[model samples]
Target: MNDAAMPKGPATALEHFDVLIVGAGISGIGGAYHLKQQCPGKSFVVLETLESFGGTWLTHTYPGIRSDSDLYTFGYRFKPWVGPPIATADEILKYMGEVIEENDLSPHIRYRHRITNATWSSRDNLWTVEAERLDTGQAVAFTCNFLWMCQGYYRHSEGYTPEWPGMADFKGRIVHPQTWPDDLDLKDKKVVVIGSGATAATLVPAIADDCGHVTLLQRSPTYFIPGRNANELADILRELKIDEAWIHEIVRRKILHDQDLFTRRSFEEPEAVKQELLAGVSAFVGPEITEKHFTPSYRPWRQRIAFVPDGDIFQCVNRGKASVVTDEIERFTEQGILLKSGQELEADIVITATGFNLNVLGDISFAVDGKPLNFADTVTYRGMMFTGVPNLVWVFGYFRASWTLRADLVADFVCRLLTHMDEKGARKVTVELRPEDKDMPLSAWIDPENFNPGYLMRGMHLLPKRGDKPEWQHSQDYWREKEELPLIDLDDSAFVYAGTKARTPEPVG
Candidate 1:
């Protein structure tokens, strides 16, 4: 916590700032950097619920918790990532810490400040944010001219784990990776991990040697890209004695360009892309094993493709340290899990690597002018701002590209919007549907046909709607957004700016 920026008023009094940023994670830190660099005059403070920074990386303590996406693109654009493409949780934390230290961001960040409610006052052109100190249990109030939400999309307190029948009867311990116990003893323990997502893949290889035997159980197979973690482009650039910053930018752009092509190929040539992905895994596990436990029914990119460095999971399987099982769970038995195929897998411990529960707006209660706000009732403006919401922007990143890509883009947009507001002397800015877009078809936040993750699907009803117009929807296209976002016209009809003209005071006499 930065004592200098700490609220010094009474508990009931409001500590004010020009902008209030939520969360101190990657997006929040990036937002802070952009704000300080671009809008140096604006006063701001960051409120984070966690004890420290590194949101997901700090929260997840499961064995082998690492990035599924390469760090070259995952890392911030302003910062240089010199490590391997695939980095562990500790490495990511170190990288994020460096960003904070290098940029002198610690002074503006207030950790353990959990925002509970936010209310917008249209008349006053401000937002009243209510939070409580996790350490002191004291309520705090804050007023900000604008709100920037970068709290991330999922609940970090607990992971999503489906209840199994007879789970209570099971004698072994059951744990969810999101809340992995620090004292968890896996030595010589026969462990069965549920779900075959990135978490399971990462965990199996990390603990395979310690466990007597580890099994990855999945209801259905999922796609993975298994390859060397090193980035050839970055290695070559380094060998050429290139500056680290230049190497970072060069490698990042190259990876993104290739990613764009791969994304296009996935949609255009689905089967070819699918075969290419499976072939990568087949190199280590053989075609038979790949077909049995690695082949997904859906086409490539239906869900996220976890990247496995050096095919570690398959290597563990070859060494007889780990095994993969593809079957639906019947129920939990006294010994372990009973499969629908009438197979009983005995295990001393069960780890659920299941996904997460989506969190909308940090699950913070929001109100506008004393009226409760239901996010689902509003429409999204490029998936950042809401139709009726004023002076607030949320950072919702891409599903395909690195999340930081969109975060950086949104930071740029917010800073630009803030600067525009200052120039126009406007205090409130809200996005509204234009007359031409009044009859545009409204749909789910995202098109399920395009991308549908389980967490998003479960929480779709709670999210805002999307309109047919590109401005009224989040395209989730980094390639297009990188160009279109900065070019967005703030003076367009979709934007409603107010509080510019000062009201004349009635007779003083």
Candidate 2:
């Protein structure tokens, strides 16, 4: 009970930090800069609900976004993207504002605040939180001893708007490549775009040169793949001087061991070499749009194939300036879009690129002494702590390689579990994974039907399994997570720690 005895409306209280970090994104500023570089006199903050700080590159602003991995494996292995190879979102928000002003981390960041709730007191082990502040809507509170979330999912930071049916009587201008409006101007008009994944193959070759006819639509079928990503091998490893943090940890462990050996040989031999990589993507989308819609019924790495670079959405749908339409929208009219075989289509602008809106981690709420937290009855402990949740930690990444290489191996396993709880004084730690550690059968590419969230398939049954090296495995490979989480050793016994009392300082007002 601090933050000056929490009360008054949009609350405000403080003090008691040894880490709080909810979502200053990029996995809570890379787990608060590796827990302030391994507990450098610990006391952290980071809240951030956006007052600006590139979480999803400053909340994604549609139109040709970019970075489908490859800025030296989507940056951050102690910061290393000297630029280019798919970046732009204002150059990854100016490289996250130069990694928060070269780690001065904007005075431990607070921004627009917005946490919403957190609990776990257990006779003052700490973790009170609360937050609100979407600009003076007030409400705040704090008390830490480690929490960390790193909010990833999505909860309408504006995007994912589906429903469709007559969509407020169409009349054009629908958009939603995560809220892409930016003064809506589709030159010759006609647009459309619906969804085939990866934001409808990167918004149909980036709004087909200012649209005049686009279409896309698709309700199923997605395995596009063509992405080239060339910053000319990071400018020939910065003119062979290399060491941009060892070439972003060896090109993010060689693109996470070549996307886990091409998704484990395209799912353990999909009739020999994933049917020749789906017949070389149906001879590069030819045979009448690969039998009318790049053939798919779920197979090639189940779902996740929307790279498109050199093939640029199959050369903007074979030069007709885009037009895919596999069909299924079924409703929405005021000026077009009504397919399910009825075929209406028209549109002057529609876009959906229908996806996102999962909200497992970002919906944040948690509780413990006050009970709450039914994060579907907790389970994930190694996929970043949970089992009974004690000094919390969330992070979450890898929908199959390159989400900042499993968020830089969960920020080097949370700075090697906060330097093995500061050399055993141990104030708190959790680390789980041992219900007989799920008796084998884990990596069907981090299964749980490849994430539709059941708290991310019960947090991939507390991760770290895919062995055969890669240092006791969870290795989405990246050079075995740079030799098992940044050159190993931080003590282990698979984490657990406890002890308390030593985290007091608060008052920041």
lDDT of each: 0.92, 0.69
Residue 474 displacement in candidate 2 (angstroms): 16
Q: Which ten residues in a row have the lowest lDDT in candidate 2?
A: 467-476
> Tens-digit lDDT track for model 2 on 1-509?
43434444745556567778888767777677777776678778888888777777777778778777666666677787777666768887788778888878889988887777788876667788887776666677888887877878666566556575778888878877776767899889998887777777887888798888898887776666674556455568779898788777776666666767777787677567555655666666766667668777756755556556676888877788988878787789999888889979898888776776557666667788888876544445435565567887677676655666677677767766766677788777655544445453434225444334233343443233342222223333344455555655545544567775645545664
lDDT of 1 at 307: 91
Write candidate 1's Cα lDDT for 1-509 as tens digits.
Answer: 55334554446567788999999988999999999999999899999999999999999999999999999899999989999999999999999999999989999999989898999887788898999887666788888899999999999989999988989989999999999999999999999999988999999999999999999999998889999999998999999999999999999999999999999999999999999999999999899999999999898887888899999999999888999999999999999999999999999999999899999999999999999999999999999999999999999988888899999999999999999999999989999989999899999999888887789899999999999888989987899999999999999999999996323223222
The TM-score measured for candidate 2 stands at 0.35
Score residue 286 of candidate 2 by CA lDDT.
66
Among these predicted structures, which one has the highest lDDT?
1
Quality of model 2 by C-alpha lDDT: 0.69
For each candidate, give its TM-score against the true structure: 0.96, 0.35
Residue 157 of model 1 has an lDDT of 88
Q: Highest TM-score, which number?
A: 1
Report lDDT (Cα) of residue 1, candidate 2.
Answer: 46
